[model samples]
Target: HSSMGEVWDEEMSSSMLGSRLRKVVQNYQAMNKYNVENTGPGGVASRPKLSGSELLCRLKSQVQVLTLTPDLQPFASLSWSSQLPVKSVTSELGPYKSCAVVSSAGSLRNSGLGKEIDSHDAVLRFNTAPTSGYEKDVGSKTTIRLINSQVMASDEHRFLSSSLYSNGVLVGWDPAPFSANLSQASWYNRTDYPIFTQYQRYRRLHPLQPFYILHPRFEWQLWQQIQDNMVEPIQKNPPSSGMLGTVVMMSLCEVVHVYEFLPSRRKTELCHYYQRFYDAACTLGAYHPLLYEKNLVKRMNQGTDQEIFTHGRVTLPGFSALNC
Candidate 1:
């Protein structure tokens, strides 16, 4: 098993990325798409670093896994307010003894982790990743599916007609401005993706499905924790859905075992297990601070390096399990 630094740095280094991907990471860094303004003390190098346990405690105390509610604006006055799930995500689908967070990484292709993933009381899958054919590799059970706004807003995904999304509880999120102020008019006016219309449309069709939109603050707060723990500035974009979903599970479950969110020895350039596409950016960071996010997860891992190598798994105690 490789050290965390060896695996992450080797894959994330400029020398490892092809020229095209190198340029893409640089371009996103320059874009600062979310208008992120770093107000924290310099970086990890500038301060005494917190141990993994301390970091975990801080996260348990500070990060709030919140979803949009009737109290929030736009939703408050809009027709969709009543449609929003009345229960918190934790109260609605949580407090599980064991939960699994399944990543779409290509490294999962031949790992044959399906049964183990399904063993969890609840399983969370991201975006449009499927399990029909690859059930041996990825579990067939999906208790919750977390989607980005792009999946809902883009017709290319066939969001309205797809059966993949219909089986599980659905949670959607969009990258809001860095301020993360839901009360501001600017936030609703300029979301990264115009998903509100599509979200409402889906609600009308499946009135009984438990669908929820994550509050924008959840992403920015999680992003700040990632930034605060790093030595260098990460990409200005919000954390990826993998990172967001991991935290969401952390909040709801007693234990979270995240599979392949960090690459295993089986790591490959193939983006998703079900897709033939290849891109290092999908594993590392291009638009999202994936590398940094992975590093933070590594720090908080309760599992051993051998587990990471063999199973591509990192086990974490949920907030309820933490003493803090």
Candidate 2:
């Protein structure tokens, strides 16, 4: 039987909780930063992840071949499910022109990044993981990250952690292709974050895209098709006529100004309180995009005495992007 009192386990539950919370915060911050930069018309995007019967229509519509020459299949098949044979991401429709087949250089850099953050283990790993910038330059590269890895007493509390940008652009968390189930999956969408206000607004407004994207000049026609068929149907649906849901729509005019005011680079800050929104997300464990999902409006409308993670930003050396 469990009691309100602590049941002694050898495990450091609170410490682990703190560490996990930190991870959630850092990832949320990086992803939030990514949303701002990578989004917009004519920008790098996830391959065509059409869903439902529409996906079948798309499959029938086109056929293009992408060669598997240098071999990324073994790495790609990292997240296969027990029921499904082939790997599938809900939104990773591929065959795009701009994917960078990153080499072991990024992987090695990420591994060493782990070392740089852990102060106790920093010296040990620093000796082993050489910071070889010129392993092979496929032109300039960059990685933006938030790193919150420091040793401190229980009495100390920190809300914001460092945001790491190397060379010029924000560093991506050079993820291992198949290594999906680790910390990335752990914090799926816990509402412990303080950022629910932004999410709540997002849900109420329910924009067609995560952050409303600018239309691409080239693909404007096709883009409208996808947007009208897939996006608007879901996003524009008025909250089903029922009890007034907990979520309230953010003023559309305001959101439009916020999204449209972005600079031509399409890589500027996405929101007025972008930093705070992410800070709340990190403080709580809102790891998956779904935490900001509108479906949970009824559930998260009310508050919970939840836990939170601290934001961490760490600059990992050895890479930079050309544009950023």
Candidate 3:
């Protein structure tokens, strides 16, 4: 079972937890520093850092065409019977002028960003992060909810029953082998979590809800771009859901404002705004290539770092507007 019991030892005293937490942060910082210093001469200069223009050009060339939703025929091979194919998300929420990608980072706490977040034309939030009680921190508006396969498979009850998911556009993704090419057969067999059955079930129950599986290739393409552009080589893992959602919005909208994806002045170890639990890995990343993702975002960010620090906001020009 997916449990954080070992990761978060509840028996530890609060004072002890805080003391140990400092060491963990120190170790992570050292490791990250080593990774950067050992990479090449003069750190960032050793590897070619993509300028804003270059980064935008690469994103336009490599990532913009990759779609988050699968094609119609992908479901044909599966035994699941459906009279209608899964609807295209773009068809439902097409051509937004401005959008916001709201991250679940704890740095978002007390930033008073709710009104600004809700002001966008569309807002995208990650898996299982609630907006009920924390409306002041995280806006009540959710135009799109992006989830991973774990949420679809393990939390089927909530996913199927919750009114939270029923209101917004739902897009879920599962990781395939890093090099796996896009095909219904390969994707079905190689995915860490096979969500086809669950997806079919959800669609059948809520025919009106726009739920789509993000194409596995789209994820890998972004991963490749991240690796290619970063100063230091990143882990071979997939990009975080936050990064994926940002690119998704960038492709669909004209201007995308990403909130707290990169920790700002109010940065905290708290994993999410909804929970009191803290994990440095949430920001630094354990499984996903989040550190590199943050660097990439910072490189591409049009706004000043001061703005990012105080407001926890980064403004980006959409991929559609990039002149490749």
Candidate 4:
């Protein structure tokens, strides 16, 4: 798409270039293991993977994280109405730079619910009580599946059902085979995430008899976020000129995003930043509701085209404005 009379032609940066920005595969290089930390007072997500005392002992150069520990309970049972709760988290080793802050309990095995909730916590808590400086956890996924049954390990997998009660129970899932209950706004449980679709497709190839199916229990709680959270932050809004125009925000998934300024000085500058942000989003694999908004370029000044916070792909009942 053309913006500010200029054309954006660059493509999304691949892992080859992104590798330098991130810690790489994390394993390909020496794993920068941090210390294990215990949950503070209040309900917390379980860290069965990392030992608390051991967690406290792994700090390398220094990385401070905000953790949620059960004050009276063992595991934090977040519900639909529950909002993210965090306070006094920032006083770390120094001024925070650009980086994704991870949860102390992130276990690769339980990637589904563990980091998901933490990501939600990152956004929810950041909006209210920001812990570290800079956008800490915008790359997080705001939803999670809760398992409270004793079925097979795979049985505990969470799938999006077709229908649901007010309490958020999965009655069924599909195109309704007639009409769809879900919309294109947000990504739902189906073929992509949680890896259930792959098994389902393969299983159908062999079955004619009753097949063993593992079911999951409990509803997922959506994370709270600003109504116009999709609206990218316009750094150096106006007045000042140059190539510093930028858009930045922390996504519900706890990822830090930066869309460089679209210089609209002439249509050329405007188009430049447009492609930079757009291409940057694409380059960064920003497919979520965050930077994935349609062409939301609006003219703020001569060289700056502003993208007012617009709509997102997903919408909940009470929070119609909250984007996916």
* Deviation of model 2 at 258, angstroms: 23
Candidate 1, residues 1-324, lDDT tens digits: the string is: 545532333123333567887778767767876778863752447687777789889998888999888767777887668888886687777678999999999999999999999999999999999999999999899999999999988888889889989988999999998989875475787887877878888999988889988988889889999878877666788899999999999998999999999788888999999999998889987899887788888888888877788789999999998896
TM-score of 1: 0.94
Candidate 1 lDDT:
0.85
Candidate 3 residue 277 C-alpha distance from true site, Å: 1.1
Identify the leading candidate in terms of lDDT: 1
**Model 1, stretches more than 4 Å misplaced?**
1-20, 42-44
What lDDT tens digits, residue by residue, belong to model 4 across residues 33-141?
2111221211222423222222212211121222222221211342311111222112211121222222121111112222333432221111011122222322333
User: Model 2 over residues 1-324: C-alpha lDDT tens digits?
Assistant: 422322112111112345655565345534432112212322123445334334323322321111111123332443321112122211222121121211111212222223322221111110011223432322123221111112111113221221111122110011111211223232212212322233234324433212111111211222222222322111111111110000001100111000111011111222211121223222122332221122222111121111100111111111011111
Off by over 4 Å in 4: 1-89, 93-287, 292-324
Q: lDDT per model, in order?
A: 0.85, 0.20, 0.72, 0.20
Show the lowest summed lDDT stretch of 10 residues, model 2: 243-252
Indicate whether candidate 2 or candidate 3 has the larger lDDT: 3
How do all models score by TM-score? 0.94, 0.16, 0.81, 0.18
Q: Stretches of candidate 3 above 4 Å error?
A: 1-47, 65-74, 79-92, 182-185
Per-residue lDDT for 247 in model 1? 94
- Per-residue lDDT, model 2, residue 266, is 17
Q: Please give the range of 10 consecutive residues that has the lowest summed lDDT in model 3.
A: 5-14
RMSD of each: 2.5, 23.3, 8.8, 22.6
